[model samples]
Target chain A: MTALSALIRRDIRIALRVGGGALIGVLFFLTVTVLMPFAVGPDLALLTRLGPAILWLGALLASLLTLDRLFMADHEDGSLDLIVMSRTPLELACAAKALAHWLAAGLPLIVATPVLGLLLNLDGTATLAVALTLLAGTPALTFTGMIGAALAVTLHRGGLLLAVLVLPLSIPVLIFGVAASQAAITGPLSFGTPFSILCALSLVSFVVGPFAAAASLRHGLD
Target chain B: MSLIDLANPTRFLALTARVLPWLAGATAILLLIGLYQSAMAPDDYQQGATVKIMFIHVPNAWLSMFVWGIMSVASLGTLVWRHPLADVAAKTAAPIGAAFTFLALVTGSLWGRPMWGTYWEWDARLTSVLILFLMYLGLIALWRAVEDPSRAARAAAVLTLVGAINIPIIKFSVDWWNTLHQPASVIRMGGPTLDNAFLIPLLVMAIAFSLLFITLHLAAMRNEILRRRVRSLQMMQANQKAA
Candidate 1:
């Protein structure tokens, strides 16, 4: 438990400090959402209707922006080898790293949702619903993305490869996250159904991600 | 013969050599017959000549799924049993699978233009298949991205398994979302309700496509094995020179 906590703490500190891409992800999220009103035009009604989707896409891209470094920094500094060789299981270490990534990178995107939602002309309730769905959905993105990050870690210039690999896997999360938010904002359908499924996706990825990432990391290690 | 026996690269090569000609001959015959049958079949009352696209579209769609199934099984072989040819099988199959998937998408779009009045729709089925196509491309890219063959194989195997698990979820989610495409008319509980006119040709084309995949897969695997041999020999010569 101490080892896992320590690992998580170290990762969070590194991500929050200078050169950490966590802030970059947030800034990217802001840029994507901010550009929406201008490119999409000044129609408030259209923007409001499109708000949840825009926010979700921003969050997804933001997470991707930060995810490439999940293992790259450690792999470069040789700490990844130590972590893999440590008494703590590599799977647990991977999960810890992913968890830290979500805290530093994903959490802020969710937090920024309401503010960014306003740019798209979304009202309070709609913004909240979008925020709520993003909160549920982004962990699935982070964890599943960890597999891509690990697989690409040993490659030269693997950031683009990571995106290609991770983006397809993330479609379901995007679908459900947007669906749940849409359900909440405008309703013939119940929000609970998609929301539950969204949560289930996160839970499933939480279990599968660590194992798959660890396997790829171990395989990639020389 | 046991799988272990076939694991010998030379034996596998010899077996594929014997099998390839027969497979190609059968594929050619089946494709010719299937095309003849499809061409002769009377036009559908509703869709008219455009319905003929089904012959090509359905088989490619089926092959898209079929090839993924092959990759998943080979992935299991790579990860679980560490079968010598498994990664080769998985890697070699990806581009062929991607080609089929591309064919499916393009043909589906062509069929859609005459039927659904649009070349593309955000319909769940179309979206999911597009995702599947992207996944195939990603796998192929990953195979090239990694430097080490063994490492690439293992990484790609893990990815294939991950994709296998995602496939069911993708199918289910797409089903749950609004389906713009027609529901299963061919594979449903009532079996195929498709007319014998369409059914027979469809089956033949499907068989042809499957045979094509097998023949291509075997040839590609043989090439991969030879590529590895050349790589090792080159490395050996370089090492000797260095010494």
Candidate 2:
């Protein structure tokens, strides 16, 4: 437990320090959300309807942009080898790293959503709903994106390949996140239904990501 | 020979070398019969001749999923069993599978333009299949990007297994969502809704396509084995010169 906590602490510290790129995800999210209004034109009614989707899309890409940092830096510095060789299970270590990644990277996107949501003309409740769904859904993105990070960790020039490999797998999360927020905004169906599924996706990813990442790391890093 | 005997790449290559011609012959024969049946089959009262497109479209769609099924099994072989040819099998099957998926998409679009009065719809079935196509391309790209063959195979094996999640979703996408594409009429709870005129030809076409895939996959595997041999042999020659 202590070892896992230590690993998580180290990762969080690295991500928070100068040039950590943790804040870059939020900036990218901001840029993407800000750009959408220009592309779609400044029609407030249309923006309100499109707000949840825009926020979700920004969050998804933001998380993806940072996901490679989960393992690439560790692998490059040889810290990943030590972690892999340590007494602690690689799966747990992977989970810890992903958890740290979410804390540093994913959480900020959720925090930024409301501010970005305003640019799209979303009201308080709608912004809260988008933020809430992002809270549930972004972890799923981080965890699953961990698998891609691990798979690409050992390869040369793997950044673009990471996106190609991971994006298709995240389609379900995207669908559910957007759907849940849409339900919260304008709903015949209750928001609870899609929200529950979004939570389920996160839960499922938490289990699967660690194991798959560990497996790929074990196989690919050699 | 038992499955174990074929685990040796040399024996597998020799066996496929002999079997490939016969497999190709059988594919050719079955394909002829299927095309004839599809041609003779009556058109839908509503769709008219465009219903014949179903004869090609359905089978390609089925193989698009079926090829992935084969890759998933081969992926298990690569990851779990570590069989010698399993990596080759999975690697070789990807392009053929991607081609079938491409054919399925193109043909579906072609049929849609005439029947649905548009080239595309963001219906669940169509979108899911498109995702599957993108995944196939991604797998191919990953395989190409990775430098080491063994490492590439393992990374790809992990991906193939993960990507299998989309297969069931594609199969049931119509039923799950009120999709523009029709739900499963041929494979459903109450049995096939298709009549004999359509059913027989569809089945024959599906079987032929499956055979075509097998023949292509085996031939591709054989080629990959030979390609690796050449690569290693060239390395050996270079080492000899250095020595």
Candidate 3:
């Protein structure tokens, strides 16, 4: 327990100290959100309708941009080897790192989403939906991101590869995230179906992604 | 059967070489008949002659998914059993899978222009297929990006397994989402919706395409094995010269 906590805390400290990745992702989110309105023209109604999808997509892509970095720094500095050889299992260490990543990247994106939601001309209901959907959906990103990170840890140019690997695996999250948000915006949303589906996806990734990542790390070392 | 029956590279090479010619000949015969049947088959009342593209389009789509399935199973074999040749098999299969995917997309687009009145629609089947193609390309890219052969194999295998999630999504995306693509006809309830006239030709083409993939896969695997041998030989020669 203490080891896990230390790992998580160490990862959080590294993420916070770097800070550039979080800033770039948030700025990218804001830029794309603000740009779509101009490109599509001032159809406030249309913007409001698509606001959730736009935010969700932007968040997905933005979070993806930082994924390759999740382990690249550690891998390059040889810290990854240490982590792999640590007393705690690599799977647990991966979970801790993923949690730190979610906190540093996914959590902030969700918190900023509502504010960005307004820029896209989203109404109160849509803003709330967008926020809620992002909140539920981003954990899948962190989990899957760890898998991509582990896979690409040894490569020189892995940013694009990480996107390719992670995005396809992330389709379920994208599907449910959009659905949940759309349900929220439009009338007569039961919400339970999409919400549960989103949770199921997150739960699956949370459980499975760590082990897959650990396996990937082992393969890398081998 | 012994687990290490395939551990010998020379044995694998000899075995594949012996079977490849037969597979290639069978592929040729099957493809010829299949193409002829697909060409001669009657047009659909709703879709007219363009519907005939399904003979090629559907088979390519089938092989696209089917080849990926094969690759995934091979990947699991490689990872679990540490079967050296399975990695080569999976790696060799990637481009063939990509080719099938490309054909599916192109033929689908050709069919779409006349049938759906648009070259592309953001439909579930088409979208999933596009993702599948991307996954193939990514695997192939990873194969080239890594320097070490074993490392490359492991990385690509991990990717193949990770990307396996898209297979089910591709199969069922049409059912789940309200999309422009039509639902499953042959495989769904009430058994074989299309007429036998068209279905037979489609089946022939599908079988022919798969045979062609196997033939091509064997040829490519042989080439890959030869390449690895040549690489090792060159390294040994260089070392000997330096000594």
Candidate 4:
């Protein structure tokens, strides 16, 4: 537990350090959210109706953009080899790194959600709904995305391929996140149904992501 | 012969050499029969002749998923059993699977325009199939992006398994999302509601298409094995020159 915690802390610190990956995700999220209303037209009603979707998409893409680096940095620096050779199982190490990534990168997107939400003309409740769904959904994105990150780590240029590889895997998360948020915003349907499913997806990815990532890392580095 | 015997690329090549011509012959004959049946089959009173598109569309749709299923099994062979020809099977299947998926989507869209009055709808079935197509493209891209064949095979195997698990979840979520937004307006085109006249041609066509996939997959696998041999031989020649 201490080792995992330390690994998480080290990752979080690295991500928060100068020229790090954490905050840039939020900026990308902000840019995406801000760009939506321009391409979509500035009608307030339209923006409000579209708010949840825009926020969810922004969060998805923002997290995906940052995910390509999840393992690449460690792989390049040779720490990934050491980590693989360590007593702590590679799967646990992967989960810890993902946790740190979510804390540094994903959490910030959710934090910035309400701010982006306002720009999209969403009211308080709607904004909260989007934020809440994002909170539930983004972990799944980061974790499943970690699998892509691991697979692509050995490649010299993997950024665009990473997105292509991960986005389809992220589709269910996007579906449920947007669905739950839209339900909260306006619904004849109950929010708990999709929200619960969204949570279930996150939990499933949490289990599957680490093992898959570890397996790929083992195969990749050798 | 057992799977182990076929694992040897040379044996596999010889087997395919003999089997492929027969497979191709069978596929051609089946396709002709199926096409003839589809042509003579009575058109639906409601959809008129546009209904004939089902004879083409439904088979591709079925094969789109079926081909992925085949790849996923071959992926298991690669990652678990580490079968020699398994990667070749998985790798070659990707493009064929992708092509079938493309055909499925295009035919479905063409069939949709006259029937649904639109080329596309965000219907659950359509959306899930679109996601499948994307996954196929992603798998193909992953294969091409990786330079090493063995490493690429393992990586692609992991992805294929991950995709197998996700496809069901994606389908369920899309269904939920679609239903939540609005109830399905049209009766599902390829359901049990298909009549005997339609069903017969559909089955024949489905079988014929599966044969086509098998024949192509075997031939492609043969080509891939030969290509790898050529690559290894070229590398050996380069090494000899360097010496």
Candidate 5:
């Protein structure tokens, strides 16, 4: 437990302090959300209707933006080899790193939802629904994205490959996250259905991602 | 010979060389007969001549899924048994799978343009297929990105298994989502209600496509084996020179 906690703490500190850390992801999320209004034009009604989708897209992209460095920094500094060789199982270590990534990178995107929601002309209730869905969904993105990050870690240039690998896997999360928000905002359908599926996706990825990432990481070891 | 015996690359190569010509010959014959049958089949009362596209479209779609199934099994061979040819099988199938997927998408769009009045729709079937195509590309990209062959194989095997799990989810979710494309007609409880005219030709084309895939896969595996040999030889020469 201490080892896991310590690993998490170390990852979070690096994410907070290095390369603009969580700030970069949040800023990128902000830029993506803010640009949607301008691109879609000044129609407030359109923006409001599109708000949940824009926010989800932003959050997805933001998580992906920060995910590339999940193992890259450790791999660069030779810590990944040590971590792989450690007494703590590599799967647990991977899960801890992903959890730390979610805290530093994913949490802020959800927090910024309300403020960014206003720019998209969303109401308080609607923004809250979007935020709730994002909160449920981003962990799926982070954990799944970890597999891609680990697979790509050995390559000299793997950033773009990581995106290609991760993006399609996240489509279900995007679909359900947006669906739940849409259901809440305007509904003939119930929000619970899609929300439940979103949670299930996160839970499944939580179990699967660490093992897969660990396997890839071990295979990738030089 | 035993499966393990065939795992030897030289044995595999010899076996494929013996089999390739027959496979290629069968594929050509089947394709010719299938196309002739399709062209001769009476036009659909609703779809008219455009129904011909189904012959190509449906088979391509089936092949797209079928190749992934092959890869998934090979991935198991890699992870579980550490079969010598398993990674070669998985790696060689990816590009062929991607090609079939691309054909499916293009032909699906063509069929849809005439039937649904649009080249594309965010329909469940279409979207799921698009995602499958993307996954194939990602697998190929990963294969290219990694420098070490053994490492790439293991990494890709893990990924393939992940994708196998996702395939059913993708299918189910697409079904749950609103879609314009018709639900399963062939594989349902009733079992393929398609007319004999269309069914016979469809089956013929499907067989042809499968055979084509086998022939191509065998050839690709052989090439991969040769490429590895060349790589090792070049590395050996470099080491000798350095010494």
Candidate 6:
């Protein structure tokens, strides 16, 4: 198999075998969504209004949970070294890892967002927007996330540090993600504006983030 | 010969020491002038004496970013050319950057209270600057957290370069969004809109702050090099004793 396919498959198998990381992330999202409505009371209108932001925030926090694991395990067991030694370029390897991460953590949260969105009293448009934005923007979370994971690979306790380091950088994602979702519910903004910006951000991340991660991994290896 | 020769730490140290006094003097002189001008500058017609806060606030904010840019370039040097001094330069700049960031935040809040009727607002420029401060703190903390100095330097260098992305976002957030913060007055498409009196003092403060940053960075780099030497000497002595 090609390196890309092989890497992707390996990650999928690993993700399935472990099972808990993605589950925990989605469960965290659900828990936050579930608990927030209780705190805000039965004001379904308020809930609906906040639905997109709540969903986006949940997704942000969820993705943050899985970030430390992205590189730490491979780094610890020396698998990272082997991967670095592989003929495939580090950027490709980074993409594979980020892609797997999105599939594993981001995709699950996205799939489960509708159920959570409904709990928040979202209408069909908001629900669809929340799901679609998460679908498009989660890749960005994973992509830019690679840079954070790569930087923190050598640290002993990187979980909290990774969140601190990555969260601020992810603000643009949060801004556009929530804006896109909210725009979907509100008046005249077609999906094209925020959606296109989100996609552009994702594309920029997909291209630049991998190369930066590659550089970081090389630095870590040294 | 001069270029290649300075690669020697000893020569670099000697040259820096020789230059330090002059840089320090210039910084001191500029700061004196900046403070005097800023203190005497007339109050804004709209803002009253509170406008004076801009002198310190703007300079500190500019240096906060200026120091980060310096760190980013130094980091690139460290990562790309493996310049031994570059890591020292980057590491040394982090805390100074953090200090400038803190000063900017505090002064900005102070300025905001008198002008905006509140101490804090989630204005784009403020929010981004606050984030920049956090990034500086994180980088400095990361540097101190790692046990091995070399490894820590590399980690912090990577983090600095990555965090450079935030600078533009902070600068442009006001322009891109409907931020509460006022748009560019000093740096618009046409020209600076401020009166000459305020503009001159602001520029002087900026130059003064840049000099201050340079002086501090040079001092910090010299101290870091000395610290590293001391650490190596201590390690060698321990090894000899063990032998």
State the lDDT of candidate 3 residue by residue for A1-222, as single tens digits: 999998878877766552335555665676566556445544446767787888888899888887778888888898889999889998999998889888877888888876676556666787887788788889988898788888898555588989998899888899998998888778566777898999889899999999999998888774
Top candidate by TM-score: 4
DockQ of 1: 0.03
lDDT of 4 by residue, A177-214 (tens): 99999898799678999999999999999999999999
Candidate 4 lDDT, B1-243, residue by residue in tens: 897899999998888899999999999999999999999999888878888888888899899999889999999999889899999999999999989887887777777667555454455676577678768877876787566788899999999999999999988977776666564434267578888898988999999999999999999999999999998998888889553
Provide chain B's TM-score, model 4: 0.96
Candidate order by decreasing lDDT: 4, 5, 1, 2, 6, 3
lDDT of all predictions: 0.84, 0.82, 0.78, 0.86, 0.85, 0.79
lDDT of 1 by residue, A1-222 (tens): 999999999999887763466666776787677556445544556777988988999899889878998998899999999999999999999999999999999999888887667556677789899999999999999999999999888664578899999999999999999999999999878999999999999999999999999998888888
Query: On a 0 to 1 TM-score scale, where does candidate 6 land against the true structure?
Result: 0.52
Question: In model 3, which runs have C-alpha deviations exceeding 4 angstroms?
Answer: A1-222, B1-4, B169-191, B241-243
Give the TM-score (0 to 1) of chain B in model 5. Answer: 0.93
State the weakest 10-residue window (summed lDDT) of model 1 chain A.
A35-44
Per-residue alpha-carbon lDDT of model 3 for B77-169, expressed as tens digits?
789988888898899999999999989977776776664444543345664676677678767766765556787888888889888875676
Global lDDT of model 4: 0.86
Looking at model 2, residue A126 earns an lDDT score of 92
lDDT of 3 at B140: 71
TM-score of each: 0.55, 0.53, 0.52, 0.56, 0.55, 0.52
**Candidate 6 ranges with C-alpha deviation above 4 Å:** A1-222, B170-191
Model 3 TM-score, all chains together: 0.52
**Model 1 per-residue lDDT at B109:** 65
In candidate 5, position B236 carries an lDDT of 88
> For candidate 1, lDDT tens digit of each residue in B22-57?
999998999999999999988988768878888888
**Model 2 local distance difference test score:** 0.82
The residue-level lDDT of candidate 5 at B127 comes to 52
The DockQ value obtained for model 5 is: 0.03
